[model samples]
Target: MTAHEDPDEDIPTGLDAAVTVKVAGVDQQRRHAELVKEIDDAQEAYYGRDKPFITDALYDELMLELQKLEAEYPSLRTPDSPTQRVGAPQEETDFSPLTHPSQMLSLDDVFSIDELKEWMTRTEAALGHTPEWLCEVKIDGLAIDLQYVNGRLQTAATRGDGRVGENITPNARTIKAIPQRLRPDPAQDFLALFEARGEVFVPLKEFAAYNDKLADQGKPQFANPRNAAAGSLRQKDPRVTAQRPLSSICHGLGVADGLAVTRQSDAYAVMKAWGLPISPYNKVVHSLDEVLDFITYYGQHRHDLIHQIDGIVVKVDSFAEQQQLGVTSRAPRWAIAFKYPPEEVNTRLLDIRVKVGRTGRVTPYGVMEPVQVAGSVVSSATLHNAYEVERKGVLIGDMVVLRKAGDVIPEIVGPVVEMRTGAERPFVMPTHCPSCGTKLASEKESDKDIRCPNSKSCPAQLRERLFSLAARSAFDIEALGYQGADAILRAGVLDNEAQLFNLTPEQLVTVPFYTRGATPRELKEPALVPPPGIRDGRVLSANGRRLLENLRTARHQPLWRVLVALSIRHVGPTAARALAARFGSMDAIRAAGVEELADTDGVGLIIAEAVRDWFTVDWHLEILNAWAADGVSMADEKSARPAQTLRGLTVVVTGSLQDFTRDSAKAAITDRGGKAAGSVSRHTDYVVVGENAGSKQARAEQLGVPMLDEAQFRELLEHGPTPASETPASETPAPETPAPETSAPTTRASGAPGTPPETRDRRS
Candidate 1:
């Protein structure tokens, strides 16, 4: 009040103007300071703590905003802007620390394929040509540098800050996959000194078994595999670390005898000879198309692998080219990590839903807000069973973490109880079946799942069983998903899934979907297609017509697939394929006794007995006969060959071939009826030799086995080992129209020209 009364006296008019002008400039400086502080905090959380407080999207947004502001107001910017630097300094550790020869940088990640292309374009522009690319699965684990002196392991250290790291040599020695010594090769060996860089990880099975042990002891389970690996490797006691199932895979060198390596492709071979483990999935491709194809295949089949991977890392294969491109402040200009969509995310658990399975198990599932994980949007995730539901403390209305385990099914990892509000409610397990109202009970004392008493008669069980039979790995009737399968069951189109072969579009167009209460719901409405429930009336439309078309398409499915679709316990695609390949026809397989079936290549006693029992069932036999009568493909249709030229002979391959990959060479041998043995023995018929051929060649000479050069190999292939016309087989029929005579073109591993698109996509 005193200042207001004397305002005119207190402020000179010219001073007031100056003070007002300073405010905008001061505010800009203040905002710039705030931005730097926030960015530093985020980097600290991500790099030092390994616990990111913000989503990647949010962090990227802040970085972009900071960059834009700095560009517009250059004077307000400082050298400390996150855009101008790498990660924060590494956290403190108790182990001995050593500085690296060069900074161990992290690769900048691009989440989308288009951004990946943009990174490639930038590299090409810098280097003045398209560089050869080498793609490897970006192993999701801790990075470590291993030093060697004259072929003996010296020290192993974890990548701490890029420049300095903690020594963990004692613990590293326990990993069997990482060699404590190397074999020196004159041409490629680091004769005096070298440093190898690679990843340390826990194999998936080992991690799972360790977690099981923890669960048995009433300890908290690991949230994810990566954490489990890191925690295992950094144990206080080296003996404890030794007990943990840890392994390593060498990627390439950090520094090699002070000489530049020629190519990254050669680096892998060098590491392999150094007694380090190499992943079979590694591939060297000539073009971007091939690289993309490799990534695509792995993306679809990551679950089939024994370990986990988050994405693929693409590098310029040439060491010279990489030097030309050089390094950035944070990452190399020649390499980029193309990250896959994350498999884990947090979403609100809106409610709980129960599902009845084909085996009558009543399982709980979480209905959640839609979230994208592993390339698909997931709206619901399995809670496994009632006991698990309670053990995870997954309350309805609480936020929960979801992950697509092995890129297969979505499942709840656990609940984020800290974020929960009082509005959240507890889940109550149902004592009766949700479908038929029958009482449920656990199958065994050790079992957590509650099973329904109603078995075959329950509509839910019937629908689920039919759906399983028609899964993509089975008959592959894509149009008949869960909703379509359930709808057809409720509509009484057929009593069992085997009757699906009898369906026609005419019958389907006339059959309307029925409500749970037996009320007729017309199938003509477009909105009813792919609906979730009968009461919900989601997808009860003319979808039946579309499904009928899909069902008809399934008739041509392979006999192995049909066998898998039969719902025989213990007999999946792999076992069924073994059966089909051995017997050649479904009829032959059905007539075989359990012992005979068990004799097949991949079939075990359990699977063989299950197959035999399934075929012996009267109802199953009737359904199979009816399906055959309805024109289903009941026999193996793969084009058959009588026998290859080199049948009944054994061959050994020595050294590396110019035109064939290791796998391709083996395949070629097997294709021609020769057993490809890794070593030459007295029984070996021939030894194919290449440059630098060594021990195998010496053994072959000692044993007096015939040797063949590349040109001679082709000459022998054209005429066949003993002329294919003389080959004999009792059952197999020779091709009516044989393929045009051609030289054994360089094996597929050689990246031969004119490879079909599908084959090229395999890259293996």
Candidate 2:
């Protein structure tokens, strides 16, 4: 008879109280089976469907409960439990173990900066010097060792606990990136046999597309890129693996026969010569500071990468140095993984507060207990709008999961509903605006967002508008951020976005921003600062003067920027550029009607209606007239270089520079008909790096991509790409490079009489 034969039994002591309650009427052994079933169902939904019914927090809790139950009642434990496995589900397999010539050891992982620094300190002690480190992006995918025998591909095996790995050679051959034969290189050691280690992964951009295909075929989709790659590579049939998108990045070695490489860098060089794929994000640095810089850079730009990386592997660059550092029982001491802050974390939702945007669009976000996510402390996250808040079913006092990917804004994913104590209450959006107390209005019953109609009077709206005007994507104005904009709006020195043109240094100093709602997100500013940041009674601070000059210097901004500054609904930088290019000036765009403007390329019906409505608004007209009266010219200007110089090219701009701000540098690239990308990729044409340049620069260096300093970048702007001896550009393109969506051209009608007839040229 089974231990679960009894219908009723005492509750397990080691299990969570909640779990005990969940299995109240069931027997103890039966409860263990129930827990397993529930956890497996959640995992299937998460991994197989790619659409999870429960949040990760809830899943983790359930998993914990199952583990506890199994631990306390060993008789109830089952071998088929989810906790006992790592790989995806199998159909049929003749899989057998393959012994490696040398152990495919794992690197010890360190989570925090302190721990990573401690590892570095210990490593330095071991070497009696700060050894040069080879930093490689730790791909979030299955590790594999590829064996090359007699200059031909022999076998591929998984990294199973560093000893014997499962042979998956047939499935590996399906990956196009894994070279079938090694390229002959005279410079490389004449090795007849060797094994190179690498990661097999599904690119992030392709992961979504692949998921869509699976969904269309009525098959469950994989949760993440890593899952997709692993599941695909483990298929019983090689043809199935081939049908799935899989890529490889060879990094290091496991075993070699008659090899004479002395340095890790040299080995990588030989690998590259032998036509093996390598990560462009890996580099060698002499100092620990540079290694940290690489980590920091990747942390900020991880989202920009096509493949996912949980952390970076810092390995001793010299084989001799690696030998001196030695290895532990399960891991190598010469290498350590400095993990990036996890993008997702668990925290308590204390409250939800509404944030009024520039257009009077109010969004309620959760006020979370401060938690570290993505290397930064996040106290609040956007719940989108009131409708979204209700849909997610999150409530106050609920333990919730939050996520912040790369440099993206932190967001509340959802609540751990199972952990709820019933004290949690559903949030209700107030009928009136939080900032101005104006009656809220929603255009339609289906509308997810509620807006404040009193756009002219709301302090929050005005402040946000000013901030938007100076935002990097809009105007490229330096030193005019939200804080400075809020200061000006609060002091009444800036009544409209256009008043920026008329502001004086004397008038600017009195700007005061009274903390409106006092949400926890506002950590830097105090409740009431009469003069912006000033604590003491002062009319004009020195810091305030510098801001005033920046505002003054913003007068010469281009027409496209002016259009963006106007903050027309549905009109962003791309739309503004299209409008400006088509009309040649703001006057023409303003004079055109909704019907005529709708005909313009890239100017759809929605944008056309928004622009027409904005022009017709009494307050908007007043602001435009004010700017015109202030002699803020609406003239269209042309760049010195031909617009097609960088046409169809993608560029990455990074770090602080003496000559140009981050925005201006990006603007320079865009104005020349190039795409200013946030991250580095195989398709990137140039990486313009400045002082304190982050991971993109390091990645570019690793990929052998062309890099231009400020001077060289300016030179390129003047005379175009030089020869290899002068400027070296990488020829290699990345796997699964995303082809940008191509919008078909629509011929535009010439707007109202007296408008410029020239067609717009906003390609990207």
Candidate 3:
């Protein structure tokens, strides 16, 4: 069991006779047997060995189910069951053991907001009154108990089975955060014996850097910070632990004699005075509302902190109240951990499948048993390429770790090796394209990405390109989505996107899927009949008409948008805009040499080469000619420029703006000749912050750069910044505080249409 695996906490609510369950039958008995075997195997792997075969979420779910079964049928309860033990016994024979002075316990964990509220309410009722709560970040790290005798350090141990633990005093001494001797006051007598409880961890940034270093050295990297810290501290040689930059934060007390502290917060202050590390984020809250606020604040800013925190630990502040509430068999009744939704989860890898992208590059993705993670349900994750699949060591039918951070794409971290059964089979990359039978080969000699060389005629590639053309960043065609693109190609309406604008209602009516109240699948049904309101034998659907309308409107959508729709490799909006600004016309861009194209600002050598090569392809140029013949504008018309009020200034806009889309916001700044930078720096003149504006806002504050809200940003856009002498000091916003209308943003690169700014190009 991991740190948060105490049975008292792991059991889901209403499993304790509050809700009725069907009586256990043969099916329940078989399920109970399966659950016990799985839970026992997981605990043995995690505690007995140091490898975890399953995620904390999976383990909790198993435990919940097991407890529910046991609750429903008392006959199934066994003394050797996982729920009956504090933790699996320590099996590390190399390390000497030491019995702890007192039992070190795990805190009860609550997952949802309602569960947290219920725990708080139950605690208040038991205490007879509301007690002050001490809230602190529950760091995701290994728990340790440091024993001190007569103001001097003695021994340090892990919380192995609570009563006894592995002796790691030599390795513990290597950590600078652990004080060797207590700083006693001359005016008062210090406790002769004291036990300091803390969580040992590695800083998030340092851990990432260290992982990179390890990868560079051709060494296997640790999976996470918690695992890194645990492995670093458990080294047989103390010098090995010394080499690792392990840090710790003291949180609770184990055993203290003659301590005069009346509250947990006071104990932390006393511990800090004694040179013990305590969390800077620890706070004393007088009410449940304040506790909830603290949780909410940390939940939003969890990534901004130095270390990883999985949850918030809320404890009864007063020692008297805590003592009265006392302890459960495995955890302290006075404290509970409000766990956030998991960012990483374990699920069965059902199969590995390959997908062909617009460029014909083949990427493998894992099909998983759908699991909820990071506030969403994800069933598939991209593996990038064949090499990535091999490197991750994931086999079909194995349980794999899936991670999704906020709104980012979900990815399979790696496979759990210990859980692999003999039935698992390694994935083999296909030699031929799945959609169109074309032999796959690397685009360049050194390129790891394999592609179908038949890019022009490959149905998969053409379909993907059509979808890209209709994306928001390209033609912004809403009606011609994936389904429409696939339907058009399958119905032989168009062989490729070259004839996208040539589509007519008469041609669309022939494709049953595009006709009113008729589907391609149902068209073959002999008894199937079309819905009412048909003009002739068939009529174009609303979506079909809308597609034609959108296609017409897309014809004049600026020269840059056309460049984006052409599917030129590396020629995204940023490079397209640069080319448009310099060349002005498609004819000039086609006639320009690679050196001239590369000379354009923001258009690098790679993008220039892609553009020069694209014009050389006879088929690519044929599409351009076809679109131009269909009345699509190939050149941008000259127009008067906006007032250059912000000519020399560089501004960064972050978060969602009510009046502007991400691209429109950038246009607003660039129209006035101001530089719209993605990231914040000391050179940034202003940072326009909007709703949910994340890390860019934080970086602006760190660099002491001024921030403006949507309203102030409008003022700045209309007229340049007011001089210091002209503006009143009282009216100015402090560098620390963003404007009242906007909250701080995160490090998330870019958001959806009404979301944050881009750290990278806002490409489809």
Highest TM-score against the true fold, candidate: 3
**lDDT: which is higher, 1 or 2?**
2
- Candidate 3: lDDT over CA atoms? 0.76
Off by over 4 Å in 2: 1-106, 109-135, 142-202, 210-306, 316-325, 341-346, 385-401, 413-432, 436-449, 470-561, 573-585, 594-605, 627-662, 665-764
Model 1: lDDT of residue 393 = 71
Which residue pairs in candidate 2 collide? none
Instruction: Order the candidate numbers by TM-score, best to worst.
Output: 3, 2, 1
On residues 196-278, what C-alpha lDDT tens digit does candidate 1 reach at each position?
88888876666777788888877767666777778877876665666666767677677675553588777766666555555
- Candidate 3: where is the Cα deviation over 4 Å? 1-94, 127-130, 184-189, 286-289, 512-539, 581-583, 640-649, 655-667, 670-678, 691-695, 719-764
lDDT of 1 at 498: 61
Residues 1-764, candidate 2, lDDT per residue (tens digit)? 12221112233455554565465435776767777777655543332222347665777787788777766754454324544332122223335687877899888899888898898899899889988788877888899988877766667789987889988876776565666556677876547778999999987656767888876776555646777888887888665776677777777887775666888777876776666765555677888677777787666656655578899898989888898988989898988998877877789999998899988888898998999998799999998987667666689899987878867899887777779998998898889988889999985677878899999888889888888888766665666777877776767776777577787755665554322333343334544443343333433444555565665666667787888888888888766765665677788998898887887655789999999889888979888888778776576765532454565667788666788887677667666556678877777888877665544664665556687777777876666666632466454222221111111111211111111112111100
Ranking of all candidate structures by their lDDT, best first? 3, 2, 1
Name the candidate, 2 or 3, with the larger TM-score value.
Answer: 3
For candidate 1, give the lDDT.
Answer: 0.67
TM-score of each model, paired residue for residue: 0.53, 0.56, 0.77
The 10 consecutive residues of candidate 1 with the worst lDDT sum are 734-743
